[model samples]
Target: MSASPHPLHELDPAPAPSVLALVPAPAPVPAVPVVPANRAPRANTPLMRKEHRDNIALFRYQVIRGAADPSLSTRQRGPLVRALALVDHPWPYGGTRRFSRESLDRWIKAWHRDGFDGLKPDERATAPGTDPSILLLAESLKREKPNRTTAQVKRIITETLGQAPSETTLLRHFRAKNISTGARPVATGRFETVASNEIWVGDALHGPRIGGRKTYLFAFLDDHSRMVTTARWAWAEDAIRLSAVLRPALETHGIPEVLYLDNGAAMSDKSLARTCAKLGIKLVHSAPYRPQGRGKIERFFNTVTSQFLGEITVTDTPMLPGTAPEAGSQIGSLEELNTLFTAWVNMVYHHQQHSSTGQTPLTRWEASWEHRTPVRKPLETIRQAFLWSDTRKVSKTGTVSLHSNSYEVDPLLAGTSIELVYDPFDLDGEITVNNNQGIPAGTAKPVDIGRHVHTKVINAVKDNDTATNINTGINYLDLVATRHRQSLSGAPISFADLHDHTTPKNQTQPAVSEEEQP
Candidate 1:
C-alpha cells in the first residue's frame, strides 16, 4: 500500500469558522483575598459605635472569664460555670443579668476563637416588616394570657398578620419589655405558727466523713419555736434513715400538724407519705428548687458546721463540754461523732438564744406548751405508721418474692396482688400480708431465704461499720462434707447391708442369701 500524503495523525481537516464562533468560554471566578488564620475579624464595624462594642465585649468577658482560665481542668470548669450561672451580673443593655451555663460555654468558645473581639455581640439584620406595631401586638397577646407561650404568641401573630417574626425575636422583645411567662413574683413575708408543734420543717445536711465513709445528718426543726425537734447522723440518706430521725421526733415532741419538707428522694418517699397519711399529719413538700421556707433548717445546719463539727476529735475518752480536743486526737468513728453531736446539741445549741426567735430553742419549745397541749400518738400506732410496704402478686404456688427472698402467703391470696408490709431492715422478720383492699390477709413465712434485707439496707450497714472485723476461719462446705463422712463411717457399703443397718434396733434384720452377699 502507498503511503498517505499526510501521516495518519494529521489526516483530519480543521473545523468551520461558524462552529468555532458558536462555543462559549468559561466565566472567570472572583478573587477572595486570603486572611491569615490567626487574624480576627474587626468587631467595631462602621455601623456599631465604639462604646457599644466595648460594653458588649466587657459583659461577655466578665461572664466567661472564670470558666475560661487556661489552667482550669475539665472537672473544674463545670463547677465554675455552675457557680457563675447562679450569680446575677450587670447586663450592658440593662435586663436580667443571669447567664446560663450553655451561654457561658458558647462565650468561652468565642473568646478562644477571636481573643477579645469575638466576644462582641453578633449584629444580625432584622427581618423585613418586623415593626414596633407587630411587637406590640405580640406583647398584647402575651399579656392577654400569661400562660400563653412564645410559640403560641407567634402562632397568634402569624394568623393575624399573615406573617410573623421568629420565636427568638418575639422572646427577645418580650424579655426586654419585662414580660415573662415564668413564675410571677408574689408578695412574700415571714410566716410563723401561733404555737409549737404546728409545723415541722425537715431537711438533710451532707456531713463530714466519719471513718472514711460519708455521713448525712437528717434534722427536723419546729417552725414556730425554731427548736431542733430531732436530728441524727446516719451513714445513708435513704427513707430508712429519715424514718429513724422522724419517728423519735414524733414520739418525743408529739406529732406536728404538718410536716414541711423539700422534694428530696428521701423526703418524698411513699413510705413517708403513707406514714403521714396514717398519722393524720399533713405532708407538704416545698416547690422544687425553691428554698424560701427552709431557711430555719439551713441556718441550723450552718450552726452545726461551725459550732459542733469544728470541735469534734476522736478520743478514747469523751471530751468535756468546754474542753478543746488535743492536737494528736484521731478522726472519730460514726458512733463517737453521733455521741459528740448529741451532747453538743443538748448542752449548747438548744440553750443558745436564736436571733430570729429571741429565745432559746428549748425555752421556746417549753413555753409553747404552757397553754396548749401537743398532739400525741401511741408508740405502737407510730411504729406501725413508719413501716415500709411493697405490692406483689402472689404466684400460682402460693408464694411471693420480696427482694429475691421467697415467702409463702395464704393459699387464698394466690393469683392476687397483695401488699407486703415489713421492716425494710428486717426483711427476714415477720411480713404482714394484706389483700389488695389493704385488709389483713395473713403473715408471710419464709419459704426460700435468698436475702435477709434490702440491697440498700446492706449498703447502709456497710457504710456504718467501715472497719468490719476479720472473718472467723470456718469452711461451711468442708463441715458439710465431714458430716457426710461421719454418717457413712459405720454403715455397710453394700446397698442391702445399708438398708439392714438403717433398720430399727428391735426390728429383725433381713436374712440375706449367700449368693447375694458381697
Candidate 2:
C-alpha cells in the first residue's frame, strides 16, 4: 500500500542550494578599450565578468565593514556571509526568506534522522510524540475547549513548555489515543437519572399552521421534577434558536447533570456536541422514533398541543416591535393570552406537584440542584436547531390543508408557499407559517367545529322525519317505568305522554281516508 500522507511540519527547513557545473579554464583576455569622449569603445566589449567582479568587491567591502564593527557579532555575521554568496543583484538578500535559528535547528535534526526523507515533512505520529505528559496536557485542552485548533493547542503547549510541539506530533499523540482531530463521536445512549431536574429533557414541537401558516414550539421539562423549565415559540429549531430558550432554564435553575433530547438536526450539530463536551454535561439523544425512551418530553408535547396551541390564536405582526413583520403570535393574538400562559408556567406549572413525584418540580429541584448542578449549554450548541423547508400555499379563506384538518394561516400566505423547520415536541412545536418573504404569517389557529350549538341542533331536527322514522323503542321507557318506580317524580317520561296530551277530552267521530281508517 502507498505510504500515509505526511503530517504538518515539526521543523520548517530552508531551501537547498543549487549545484552548478564547473566551467572549462579560459585564457585571460586583454583589457578592452575604454570608452572615451572622442572615440567609441570596442564594438563587442564583454562587460559581464567586469560587473560580476565589481559586485563581489562591493559585497566584500560591506562584509568586512560589518564584521569589523564592534557592535556586530559572529552569530549575526555568519548569515551576512551567506547573503554575500549571491552578489549579482544590488541586494544579495533580495526576495529570499531566511529560517530562524530554532527553525533551522529543527530542520537539521529532521534531516539527520530521516536523510532525504527529511526534505519532505515527517510522518505524523499516531500519538502526541513519545511524551505522555504532553499528551495529558493536550487531552485536558481538548476537554476544556473541543473546538480549539492545532495552532491553538500549540500556543497552549508553548505557554506550558516554552516551546511549541510540531502539529504533526500533537496529531500523532491524539491519534495514538484514538482521538480524531475532527468530529470526535459524542457520548450518547448512556443511561441517565430518572428524577426530574436530575436530567432535563428539551425538544421542539411542530404546531398547526394558522391562516395558511405554520410554527414551532420549544420546551424543556425536568426529568425528576417533571416541571417544565421553559417554553418558547420560534420559527426554527436550530441550535442557536433552542439555546436562547435553554439558557434561561439553565441559569434560572442551576444546571442539570444530563440534558436529554432527540437526534434532530439541531441537536446533532458538531458545534453543539463540542459545547456539551466542554461543559462536562452528558448530552443524550433518543434513538430515532423510539420516543418512548423520552416519555416525559413526549407527554409535555401532547399537553402543549391539547392545552396551549389549541387555545391560542396566532396573529402576524412584527416579530420584534420596530422591525418589519416577524412571527405570528401564539397563545393568542391577544397579549392577555401570552401573559396568562407565562404566568401559569412560572407560578402554577413549576409549583404544581407531579402525580409521579408527589411534589412540585421546583421543590425537588431546590433540594438537589445546587450541588449536582445543571450545565450551561453554549450558544453554539443552540444554533444547530435551525433548518429551511419550503412553505405551502393557503387558500383565499386563510386555511391551509395539512394532514386531514384545515388550519388557519396568516392572510399574507395567500396562495404562496414558505420555508419552515421545527421540533415536533417543543413547547411551541409546530410548522410556523411565514409570509412570502419569510416573516411569520401570524399565529396559526386550528380550524375546528365547536360544541354542538343551536344551529347544529336545529339542522339535525330538520333532517329527521319524526313520524315515519319513529322507533317503537320510544315507548320502552313507559313500560320500564310501570315495571319499576311507582312515584310520578321518579317515573320515566316517554312517548306515552305525547299520545296522552294529543288525545281529545271528549270522543268525537272522525272521518278519514279509507287507507288511514282502521
Candidate 3:
C-alpha cells in the first residue's frame, strides 16, 4: 500500500502549475524629477514676505559665528565677542550698525545652544507696545542730552504728548537707536596732538604675576608720534614707582607740556601734582570712568600684550635677537622682564610703522625733534620737585616728628607749624624747613631716626625687588641705565649715595682735598 501511494503522488505532480504567474508586479512610481543643487525645492520655496526676517537671521548668524564656534575656549570667545561688538556691520535694511557687547554675547550664547534657527527673532503675537512717534521722541531727547535718564525722558514725553510709554519701553528704544545714557556717540572724532611731547598720556596696566606677586605696567605714550615715551613693569602701583618711571622719561625724552593721566590713586597723588607744578607741566586727569583721550596708550598696551608679553616667559638665558624664549621658560625676575621689554620696544615696536601716523614711532619722534626741542628741567630742580613734604608743629624742644622719626629744627621754629620737605626714600637724611610762607628757614637734622623710608616706599621695595640676583647680558635698558649713571657722574647730588654733606647756606664750607673729592 505504501508503494502504490508513492506512485500516485509522483504521478499527480502534473507539471507543477506555474507559481510565478500568480505573483503580481509592483506598480510603477511616477519618476520624481530631481531638482538641481542650486534650485530650491518647489514645496519649500522662500517667500518675499519672509525675506526680511531671513536676512535678519543671516546677519545675526554672521555676527555670532566667530564667537559661537564650538571649539573655542572661553578666553577665545570673549575676545571674539568684544572684537565683533566693536565692528560696524552693513545692515540688511539700511545703513551700518554696531551691536552692543551685551547684545553680541547674548546672541552668541543663543547660537551655541541652538543652531542657526536660534538666531531668528521670535515671532511676536502683537506689535510692540511703544508707538513709532514715541520712540522717535525718546531718541531725539537722548540725542539732545546724552546724560538724560530714562525716567526723565519718560516724564518729558508724558508732558509733551499727554501720554507716554513706560520707562522700560523708552529705554529699550533708546538702546536700539544707540543713544542710551551709557552709549558713546558714533561719530566722535579721534584726538591727537600736533607735535611730539605736546601731550603724554599715562596709564597703568595690570600685568602677569611674577614670583607669586602681581605686576603693574606704568606707561606713557606720546600723543603725536604714538611713541612709548616711558614704560616700566613694577610690582606695585604707587606714586614712588610712578616717579621712578616718569623721572627717567622726563630726563631722557624731555618734559611734556601736558601729562594726561587717569584718576587712579597713584596718578592723582599730591606728589605728582607738585612735580607737575614745579616742572611747569600741566597735569590733566581724565574724567572718572571716561577714557576718551587715552586711546593711543591703550592701543600701545594692546600691542605690548600681543607682541611682547605674548612671546616672552621666565627665562634664564638671554633671548636671541629677533627670537622668542624657548617654550616653557620661566621669567626669573622683574629685571629680566624689564630688559626684555626694553629690547622689544627699541627693536620691534619703535621700528614698525604705525598705522595711524604712517611712520615708525621712532622716526616720527626724531622728525618732531628736528623742528623743536623738548622742554627740559635741571636735575636739581627735578629732584627738589619730587621731594616729599609734610607739615608738623615743632615741639617746645625744637623738634618735629615725621613718619615716627624725630628731627631737630631751628629754635625759632618751635611751637610753629612748619612744612618739612625731604626725600621719602631717605627719611634719615636732612629735611628742609619751610616757614608758613614757603620760605626756607633752616634744615632739620635727624635727631632720632627709625624708618629710613616712607611706609609706601618700604612696601614698593619689598614687592618690586623680590628677586634681584637675575643676570641679563647686554640689553638696551641696561645700556640706558649705564648711560644715565655716566651722565650723572659729575653731579654732587646722588640718590644712591645718601650722605649728610649738606652745609648751611649762610656758613662757609672748607674746600675738600683732591683725594676726598668723591
- Residue pairs with colliding backbones in model 1 are none
Model 1 misplaced stretches (Cα beyond 4 Å): 1-189, 313-330, 462-518
Candidate 3 segments whose C-alpha is farther than 4 A from its true place: 1-189, 314-329, 462-518
lDDT of 3 at 232: 80
Cα lDDT over the full model 1: 0.66
1-518 per-residue lDDT for model 3 (tens digits): 33222210121222334322222343443322333445533222236335545556777876666556666555445545656778897665445689987787677777777777777787544467767877887787667545556764664565456788887777767755667456322212299888998999999999887767777888898899888887788778888878867765675677889999999999999989988998999999999988887888888776666445544455435568998434212457775566556555665577678778899988888898886788877766777888878889999999889999988999998898999888887887768999888899989998888999888777655553444454445422343334333222222222232222342122111110001010
**TM-score of model number 1:** 0.50
RMSD of each: 33.0, 31.4, 27.1
Write one digit per residue (lDDT tens) for candidate 2, span 1-518.
Answer: 54332221221133223211111223353332334435532222236434434443343333233322334333443343344333432333233233343444344344445543343433324342447777788776655445555554664466447676687778766665666578322222334365545677878888654333344566777776667776655444565445445544443454566778888887786545654565556889878867654777776565455334433434433246565421112332222222334444554355556656677767866775566555444433332232223355778887765434456767766777754332222212345666777566555566752322222122222322111111222111222223322321211112112112222121111100000000
Q: What value does the lDDT take at residue 338 in candidate 2?
A: 28
Lowest-scoring 10 consecutive residues by lDDT in candidate 2?
Answer: 509-518
Best candidate, lDDT = 3
Per-candidate TM-score against the hidden true structure: 0.50, 0.32, 0.54
Error of 1 at 435 (Å): 1.4
TM-score ranking, best first: 3, 1, 2
Supply candidate 3's per-residue lDDT for 289: 81
